[model samples]
Target: MSNSLRLVIGEGLEHLEAHRAGAFAGDPEAIHQARVALRRLRSALKLFRRHLNPSARDGFNDALRALGRTLGAARDWDVFVLETVPAVMAVIPDQAEALGALVAPAQHERELGHVAVRALLEAPQTDAMLQDLGSWSGDRVAFSPRKAARQLIADEAGPLLDRLAKSVSKRATGLEEQDDEERHGLRKALKSLRYGIEMLESLHGRGNTKPYRQALSVLQEDLGRLNDAIAAVELVHRLPDQPGRLVIEAWANERRQEALIELPAAWHQFKAIPAFW
Candidate 1:
């Protein structure tokens, strides 16, 4: 367990360094990979929290959360401009100018967001906090690593899996009437549950966690598509009144309705997966 934590933190740190260097270049993959590394490290901290000193664990978690926010904001714009705009454009070929109008300001937003994230990464405490986390990767006095490897799957992982499963099952009802806030809430909840499952990946060699993860991925994709559509609608709502705005609204709504059609079955498949912990 200690070795695995060390490796995971090391991998995340390497990616963080890469992202920090390339942030101003506005590379989408750098933004995406860095956020992913932060998530993986956060997931690790959550899993092995019982093995960390309270101050040590809390400090790292809080710092990572703050860093993730700026990076997340930047990535959202990147997705909207680079990825989502093209799809909307394809849908309304005649309104290509309309889609570009939306994409332009978002691209500018991405540039501004990238600056904010770059400044955050260069903050004074940022380096010290990352150093502390790396040291934590090596610190194992709270629990014996070998003993944790033997018992953690049942004692720690199983209960979280059970709780998240119930939460998803409960929140997933009445999706058809759900507002934007409610749908976004579901997307975040499902992502948390999926990340929690991923934290226990090392323990799954003797079990069937892969299929369980696969089911969650499908559900996540469905929720994500819905979110992109909603974001499109919101962007169109923000644009200056023009004839093209109506066409863009119609295009986004079509995509959203299709996702609403697909969500229930995906949610059901996720709930039916046998718990793997």
Candidate 2:
């Protein structure tokens, strides 16, 4: 388990570092990948919480979470300017010019957002945090020498995956009727469970986990699109109130409704899958 933890954390760190230059260059996919690496690292920490030192775990969790928020802000704008705006333009062709004009300032905001991401990436504090995480994952005293830490992952992976799966199931109990916050809660749970499965995939094999992962990917896509719509609402409000703003909001609302209608069926399909572990 301890060795596996080290491997997982190391992989996350490597994944995160791989995208730094691309994020600095304002590549949306790079920014998204970096954010995902952070999420996977945090999820790994939580997944292995029982075997970790509390103080070390909490500090790293807090720091990583702060970093995630910084990246997330930039990501939201990238989606809005790059994806959502283009999508709206395609769907509402007559309003394209007006919508483009309304979103011009949003493009500037996205530039500033990338600048902020660059600054954080270059910050000394971030370097220090990453160094500390590497040290911890390398067994350099950040993690306590607990019995649980020494246990074999082969004996532990199954129950951990099972617990994570059950958590997701519990969160999805009333999928279609869930409020935005509740649905967001489910999304987080699903992400954690998915990450858990991903981390342990080597043990379970791609053959065994592939179908389950595919199911998770589908459900997450729906949930993610819904989240984007909700975020678009909040983001559009930040723009100057204008006629096009109402159009964008309506478009986002329509997207939200579509996702809501499909969510229950997706949730059921996901629930029908047996726990892979």
Candidate 3:
């Protein structure tokens, strides 16, 4: 087997093992990391599909996708509470009283996260899928490098780009809504675009995809900041009416509006890149 193939499989197995151990211990971070590893492994498999048996590859892909979805919601909520919410609260001290309201919800999300992690850890499907991945990874296969690269671009990268383009366009259309949920969806779309571009760059040469990838990176960053501001505002909104809460809300709103204005031009520039779609 090529070094590239071996490296991919080894990394994947490591991630799977880590995830399994973490989930068994009920570690939220481990569960999230495991999902990320599965995603990376799935991407690698797609990129190198030509070297794998079709039946086995399909099975691995399906299993990963299912597991990813099962864990994704819990991870999203965890991130919101543990990372985004706390960070926002820290920045807006005046809104501290209002921010307290979110603690309950955040704690609730944490409980759900634990439950989701436990369920996935205990699932028989997890063991079967990991075993299948191990067996497939150990199998020797031959493929023409050039042919495999071309197939990867055609089958995986092309479709991913199409999906990313559609997602961005859809998100852009809804930007005018200017609500926490709408902006959150936009952030998710930007993340998808960013990851898709990164995956393509890994398969294709970075030189060929740099402009588009950089554009995506910029868009993702700007949108992410904007989403953060929106979430901050929502946090304040949830607080009991108070003088300090109003001040925080106003600050957050100002920041959000500025980001909104900055985003359109950045988005236009990104869309203008020839390979962005």
Question: Which candidate, 1 or 2, would have the higher TM-score against the true structure?
Answer: 2
Model 3 C-alpha lDDT per residue in residues 1-277, reported as the tens digit of each score: 3445555666767877867777557566877887877777776665556566677778778988888876765666666567755665788766677666666766676577678777876888787777767666655543343545334243555665676678678877856666667767777666656555555554455566678778778877777777666665655455456555565566667777788888877878887988633
Comparing 1 and 3 on lDDT, the stronger one: 1
For model 3, the stretches where C-alpha displacement exceeds 4 angstroms are: 1-10, 23-29, 42-62, 134-211, 226-259, 272-277
lDDT by residue (3-38, candidate 2, tens digit) is 788889999999999998998788999999999999
Better of 2 and 3 by TM-score: 2
lDDT of each: 0.74, 0.87, 0.67
The deviation in Å at residue 276 for candidate 1 is 2.4
* Prediction-by-prediction clash tally: 0, 0, 0
In model 2, the runs with Cα more than 4 Å from the true position are none
Candidate 2 contains a number of clashing pairs equal to 0
lDDT of 1 by residue, 29-107 (tens): 8888888878877867765666666677777898999888889888888887777778767766888886676766667
Name model 1 segments beyond 4 Å from true. Answer: 1-7, 49-56, 141-155, 173-177, 203-207, 235-244
The candidate scoring highest on TM-score is 2
